[model samples]
Target chain A: MLKLIIENISKTFKDKQAVTGFSAELSEGVYALLGPNGAGKTTLMRMLADILKPTSGRILLDGKDISIMGDHYRDSLGYLPQEFGLYRNFTAVRFLSYFARLKGLDKQEATTRVDEVLKLVNLQQDRKRKLKTYSGGMKRRLGIALALLNDPKILIVDEPTAGLDPQERVRFRNLLSEIAGDRIVLLSTHIVSDIEYIAKEVLLMRQGTLIQRSTSEQLLDSVKDKVWKCTVEQHALPQLQKHYKVGNIQRVETGIEVRIVSDQQPLADAVNVTPTLEDVYLYFFNEEVIDGVQAGML
Target chain B: MYRQECYKIFSKKSIYLVFITIVLLLVYVHQLPTDMTMRESVFEELEETWGGPVTEEKVERARESMNAADAGEVSNHTFELRATDYVQFLVTGAAMQKQDQSERLTMLEAEMHDFDEGTYEHREAAIEHDMLQALDDVHGFYLIRSWREMFELIEPTTHVLLLSILIFLGLSPVFADEYTNRTTDLILATKHGKTKLVSAKLLASLSYIVIVFLSLQIINSFLNLLKFGGIAGWDAPIQGISSGLDSLSRLSYDGSPYNFDVWQFFLLTIALQLFASIAVGVIVLLLSFLTKNTMITFFVSSIIIATPALLQQLGTTDGFLGYLTDFSFLKLMQVSTLFTQFQAYNLFDYPVLYPYLLFILFAVVTGLLIMLTYRLFRNQQISH
Candidate 1:
């Protein structure tokens, strides 16, 4: 059976469309929800989580509508909000225990669960320390611990590593990879690299619409020959940005080195380069596609 | 649930300060002398009675001789005749015997008249006797005390505070906090985080309120008894029905009238003060929910609670405006006025109408505020 299905979901705020006609189905493994700022990625994820009711469309988990399932659906779902809040005074253990109770575990069971999750997040030593005393990375780990307290079948984490240090981010990425095998793990992030290693599939969103859904390999393949690098004068950078979708620009000792996506080489010295997931992301999110390359390829 | 909330309140430093301050204030009040003279000009009276030069050796000797004769150790005629002869001898020199005698007689007569028939002396004696009786009555109350009676005394104030704090703090983060903290996206993304968690929070907050309130009331009552002695009488002396005397005369044993028994009035005053405090708490909670900031909630609640007293004070002399004071929750805190009898021109004019009317009005307003708060919470959008 499909673990989760979202059908034509849309959400609007005041006069602005946040998420529109978004649909997806997942059975298992890691799915990366990649988008730029204000791309309705978070909105679509929220609707599937049942935290937000969609203006139109239905979300079904195991063939049961989540809106009707209510708390029962939530019982099997683990969620980490983008800006997760904590009761600053609470110790990490105490905080996890509270969430465990809310997730319907009794005292003895909650204690065992909290201890297990604290170990899973590698926060066993810091469990007795208050959240206010924790570093940003530590707090993020605690948020993960709380989300995993119920042993949820489907885990949803939004910008899970936004504030983590390089070492901690790598550790978190590895941890997510280890857990993604048996259950569906939906990861939403603006950072392409957070998901590049673990995500089996990538879903791109732009301006409240699903721009693309494909394997990480397929997304990279689509942008393979389209991305090109060229060295240009400092004064010519702005002109290049206007003419083409500039993915990256680095100021060298001599002038500026630029990475741009185009179907054909636009400059004499330009050379085709291997494309990363970021190249595909930049192509869809940034305006202006090359003449021969279809925008749908994004 | 209640135990958990109690633990939270007990953990807070602010609640500890409130408890300590109230206990200290109660103890300080209790230490005040119960036999205090109420007259404003007590010092002047003392000055007028004792401001004179000391008597000389001759006058002292004469007074001593007369005192001895009055005790019947010697013949009064012999002592009086000798005293007169000695006074006459002194009168020829520096002594003012006649003036001294007149002053002595006036002082004695005044002392006798005051002790025999004055209201202060009578009331003082009555209070001394009543206190002893009250100690006995305390034991009786303990034997027959019921949960219903205790609840009746406590529930109103407790409910007010509970409802007030819950409504205020519960609404604090509903919209304003989320917008300020920029956590709307994260919260909305969780499976049922927006809907389930918000509801859980509201439940937790309200539970905290009920626990805090009940604790405060229980602590207040215990402390009140410890400081002021135990409850023995449910009906205040002022509330008693008496016949064959005017309202003014019933308040006095002698011709001079006073407010009421200070101890009884003090107890009633504390109860009323608590009521007002709870009312202020409730109003503040409503404002907090509406404004969604601690600062706005504090300021708005203060203004709403204080406005009644301000209007009463400013408009008291304006006749029609005086009636407005009767409706104020602030006036309820002035327990002294509630126990005092107001004068009227005729039998048709009754003074009990004001407090009775005000009490009902406050109760109704409190109910309405709670209803409004519940509606606000229920209708609020769970998800951003």
Candidate 2:
């Protein structure tokens, strides 16, 4: 059983604190770190990947400090950064083979694994083609394939599905679900739906701080009865958004269909609805995710 | 791993571009010595009176013949001065008509150990001192008859020097490539990324340097031999060649007899240049780690590498600046100057050979650069 314990981690870059006092103990399941852009999701994932050391606190694997553990700890760690890149001139196969060598796989093993990963990413036909010619979705899939090269116990990926198409996103989510198995997969994304089905636990973050951590169901239950779809006149939509956390706003034939998460109903005819993870995300971080960067300073 | 790193370094089209550029430059600039053709022209011009090679009898006869000629014809009494014994040529020939030959020779010999206060005179004296020291035990001097052999050996070095510069260009991107491609995150995160992988890159760069250096030397050597058809003065002291009006200089040999033949001196020069190339490779590799931009590293590296040559061209190679520059860098690559001049840094009243001192200094600098590269890269935090 692999265990990773992050104790009071924080990162300060110049005058900005990108990650602040994040602590977690994870083992054997997919944990979705949900946050919007610039919410320190990337920074936290980088810390877990051991690519960026926290300014304070210790990250340990199996009770030993990852910092002191170094490469030995890294051997069981796989990371796919948000802005992943491959050598432009390197063919897909060569790119994977080169990385395999760096990961300390032997010649025959690296070659075999390169072929396997190429097939796993569904890029076998394009394995011999230069990476510069690969499409966005293909590159993202290749990045995922690279992350799985060493079959690590801990997998950390940040904003992985941002460039992928909708179909590819669903496929990728399924792939992540299958690979998560008995390993800790910390999947970070701002898109709530990406992890709604697969994430065993959801960690909600705003302004570099963890606001909440619970199962998806528990998170949705917290916002139960809070989500109310109310039919209102088009003119009343703006006022409704101003007073409550608006999850979705749409215009209809007669008026507008508005979904808002709030404690009290704004309309008498509004019906209570079950919250999706999106509604939960909107409930906890509706105002904070958008205004968090400037809000704390104000 | 090293092979892969080398592929990253050498397989680029830019490397081949640089190689082709250097090859073209070598073809244009490299040529055998011209001293022989010059001597033959002089011999043809003076064949009526001096129809034979310059000997002691020919010298006496030419002096007598000049004395009997009319004053107007005295100006026409000139002949090519291609004598290997430069001092002896000065004394016997009419090149120095104002000063007595015997007194000038005595003054030059005296200046070997003693110096003058006047700036111009001191420099001239120093030059002469070094020249004489170069030819100290050199005997049986002769005029330049055929320079084909002499030039064949020296011409190829242009390619060597140019190839060294090309090496800097080829290696400027070792670290910057990862940054430009945005692969540093992946590469540095791997298990062996920071340690063995870095080691592999360094080894690949060094091995490429060696291969380029040795290949250039071999190509030049072979082409030179093929073109000139002989190594005539392979074992002859350089003091035996009269270079017309070309200034004579000599290489220092670390207290060994100043009696090295041309072959030994050429070999030493090649060795010194190779050592300098190693230092240059390390320097380029160091610059590669300082930033994640290849252009910046290449630009700064060009400045650093060319500083020595620029200082020489700017005439900063004389007193204080010269003392340091002479024992530092590209001076070792100047085979002609080292072969003809006995230049040295008089350190602590001991004339230590510049090449010996230079290679030692390069080794230390390269070592420090390597350490600095490791420290910088190992502790690096990617900001972009």
Please give the lDDT score for candidate 1.
0.59
> Candidate 1 has which clashing residue pairs, if any?
A82-B186, B164-B282, B168-B285
The residue-level lDDT of candidate 1 at A263 comes to 72
| Best-matching candidate per DockQ | 2
Best by lDDT: 2
Model 2 TM-score, all chains together = 0.82
- DockQ of each candidate relative to the true complex: 0.17, 0.61
lDDT by candidate, in order shown? 0.59, 0.70
Residues A1-298, candidate 2: write the lDDT tens digits.
Answer: 8888989999999999998999988989999998766788888887787778899989989999988988888788888998978887888888888889888889999988888877877889998898889988889989988998887789998888888889878888998899888799999887889999999999888788888999999988888989999789977877887778887888888788889888998789999987898888788777774466467778
Give per-residue CA lDDT, model 1, range A1-298, as digits (tens).
4478888888988899999899888878999998877888777767767767788999999989988887788778888878766656668877676567667677899899988988887899999997779998888888888778888888988898888888878888898889878788999987889888899899888788888999999999998999999999988888887778888888888788999987778788999999998888878877623432555655
Worst 10 residues of 1 chain A by lDDT: A288-297
The window of 10 residues in a row where model 1 chain B has the poorest summed lDDT is: B136-145
Which candidate should be chosen as best, given TM-score against the real structure? 2
